[model samples]
Target chain A: MKKSWSHESKEYKIYVVLCLILGLAIAAAGLYALQKLLVPKYMRGVVEGSMIAEYYESEVPHEVLFLGDCEVYENISTVALYRDYGISSYIRGSAQQLTWQSYYLLEDTLRYETPEVVVFNVLALKYGEPQSESYNRMTLDGMRWSRSKWDAINASMTEGEHMADYLFPLLRYHSRWDELRSTDFEYAFSRDRVTVNGYYMRCDISPEGEFPAPMPLADYTLPETSMDYLTRMVELCRENDIELILIKAPTLYPYWYEEWDAQVRAFAQEYNVPYINYINLRDNIGLDMSVDTYDAGLHLNLTGAEKFADYIGQYLVNHYELTDFRDVADVARAWEDDILFYDELRDAQNAELAEYGELRSWGANAIEN
Target chain B: MNKKILSVMMASVMALSIAACASEDEDTAPVVLSGGQTAESAEGSGAQEAGETAAASADAYVFTYNGIEIRMNAPANGIIEALGDGYTYFEAPSCAYEGMDKVYTYNSIVVRSYTMDGEDYIAAVELKDDTVATAEGIRIGSTEDEVRAAYGEDGQPGTAGIEYTLGDSFISFIFENGKVVAITYTAIVG
Candidate 1:
């Protein structure tokens, strides 16, 4: 009886071993499944193109995609893109994006949908020293762009400066970032009323209401790396049969130089694409530099965007006029509404900011005509 | 008596071993016989069938939301058609789990390709009540009558019967003992 009992105990030991093995196997499998389903998941502020790729290729197919830094993002309005130029576009641009960053964004856009025209911002080199971090502005893996995702682990040069941009956007953009706190993309698409001189959209003024002066320009050369990316931007557009339009966005007067304008001309000739310098279009574009500039002259005030938009809108309408959305019923309503928004903004900025850029304070004062 | 004793002892050992193993590899999805909706308020035959399918569908999930099993991403496409409303779509990238190097937080959606077994599904989950504030999105807290009213009469029974072509609004209902407890709305932005 003792020997038989011993044999049974041995059987029990084997069963327990087997059960543990089985449990471990199932745990591993569960882990595998979970990882498979979750790892590729992304948080917000990711490259917008990755999510909207098929959508672009499918809907409102366009020939031009404007790529640039924050200036490119906030300055050019997509609503204006369609209404003014009849070109459907996505703001593949981000706030404070550098040329390198623009390169990746353009790469992502072109990867899925090949546009007929590729517009890029070239003022990056003329600003400060070449900033590679500016070019790396694609959304990182976390809620907002995180510093951990940047290659700044072991003290790289020019690491923390631009890296602080995505992390503490408020640091780089100051009051403007506050204006954009949760600025949804729906602003333009939702047909929200835009006041040209609305306090929210206006540049900040000093307590004395003095408009700040614009930053100075440099004959500074693009870093070799930055220039390489710039060249690649043109080459890629050429290879993909995309027409590259090099644009020098308008700056407040005295901040620009003639030598810089010549540099742009040389590059445009080499690339063989039409380069429209707002500087060149300065007087001819028929815009008032004083009233049009928001913060004295760094960027275009709503007044400026209106006239400048008019210039580009008419230029494109005449040159690459697709369909006069003004006539299409459903879309016409949207276009007319956008035009109406432009008017509201135009009126908003034209008003005196007695409330200190509190132009929107006169909300009911600037009601639709 | 000896044979009976041996059988009892063997059975006890086997049961303990199995239980021990299971506890170590435990998954958290409550196993209330997913084949039938959690015996919630099943007031009618239609409710009963819906309850059954809901249970079965939920039981298959090894994940939980707010400590309850994750049903189909609520407010799925079918309910949107019934509501006769439209929604905007937003897609985000997938996140993998960090420490173990496994992705535990992916929402169950086939976004990019067949290889995407699990990608974060950002669509709002619809609740039966459509009013539970669970912080995930808009939760549903209405009853069956309220759900039918919010969704309209066109909401056909079962997942296949529901038409989501109109847009992506998920209509999720909670039923206990076959009677509807709550209805929620999970807005599925593309």
Candidate 2:
């Protein structure tokens, strides 16, 4: 009887192992199916696509890169920097990139093409309320990149929560995925020969004595992670013999009340990086600081960015002694090639502008040369 | 005797499972159709201009069919039709992650429409050697910097004026006006 019982137990063990193996296999298959359903929404027509399409397909390239929310994407045009002052930079940023997510993206993509300068946009202060609809890309993470690209993906994520964005994307931004796919998504953005000028972020606005005043962050207290990323970015720049510069793009909508300006100001001072908050620079930057809003005063148009880039460009040339690449014929010619995408991009933007005048948001501007 | 019975039962169960899996595999099989893009291309690679659309060769496929370039690319996954002058198309994306070759062929299909037609499509397109347009399609409202802080720097007015090039249909901001009075949208085709 004892031997019989032992044999029965062995039989059960064999059955359990088989069942476990089968379950794992099925789960893996299901996961692959989910990925197939979701990934294409963002990465369609990746091959032989446009120039900017090619840039995003690869890792970050510029020395000091910009990564954050769409505020950066819509606000900053790296090409503007290249054209205005010949600052060879790239926008590694998009809309709604949370501090947690972009920090990892920077870390992930940094190793491939590290930048000496890093620009980040602050958001969590005003819209800390998770339900407060975000005006930018809000993906938590990405997944299933190929073997060679796997390192970039991992580096981008760092220690950030790998959360549902990868495994359960349908839960967070399914509608966004569906809606965005309607347009041409570079699907895979490469950075070769890219003309990117990344910059822009704004403070919220208040009516006359509405909140008493625009209380900017006295001392901007950034997430330890953002600060750490900044530090790492600075160090990386040092290692590469690159100079790091920080700019806080101005906003009509001040995210931080003037009270907190101390924290942000002190932090900028402590880091020894130039902090040009357009709040104070409205007059300084020569911007009217009164009438540049299109979306209930949420963001700026090309008019504002040109002035801002020009201001920053002059500063770089005067103080940093940066070269004006376009002064030479070949350099100007190179810059012209970057505009090859402007037309395609314009078509894409035309669609958005048609949806809502002045409030047209930023998105993929082209699908071709 | 009991051990023998148990082993035989277990073996029988395992056999039944294997048979069930086999049947399931046979139950649901996918059929792949060689849509017009690939098949037509190769066969027509040598055939020149079927109707002036211009095919490289007999096996080449032209992006035609009422001047719509949306669904012809992915004939199977989604459908596209016109909504008045504007047309919209939806399709599964064709993405190649890093070195992977179309591990993902189709999914996340979307439909888009524009108010413009073929002439607009062509006109908007800044072909090689074409001039850019800075002043053609730009309009400006008030120079509300209050709006600038809220929206973004992309559309705010500056000392620089809008720059357009009819030489190539190009548009750039030139900071001529005290504010950004002009902005331009270009083209989409390669």
List where candidate 1 sits over 4 angstroms from the true fold.
A1-59, A127-219, A253-257, A321-369, B1-190
TM-score for all models, in order of appearance? 0.41, 0.45
Q: A68-173, model 1: which lDDT tens digit per residue?
A: 6444544565555566656555555543445665666566555457877777767664543333332232223122222323432112224344343334332332
lDDT of 2: 0.39
Residue A133 CA displacement from its true place in model 1, Å: 6.2
lDDT of 1: 0.42
Residues A1-369 of candidate 2 have per-residue lDDT tens digits of 453335358776676566656655655555444434433233222211122223344322354466665455545556667766776666655434545445455555554665556666655323321211111112323312334234333333423223333334333333233334432243222222222333332222211211112211212234454455556655655666666665556654434555345645676688676656666676676655344432333455455555666776676667664456666567567557665555345455456566654222322122211
Worst 10 residues of 2 chain B by lDDT: B96-105
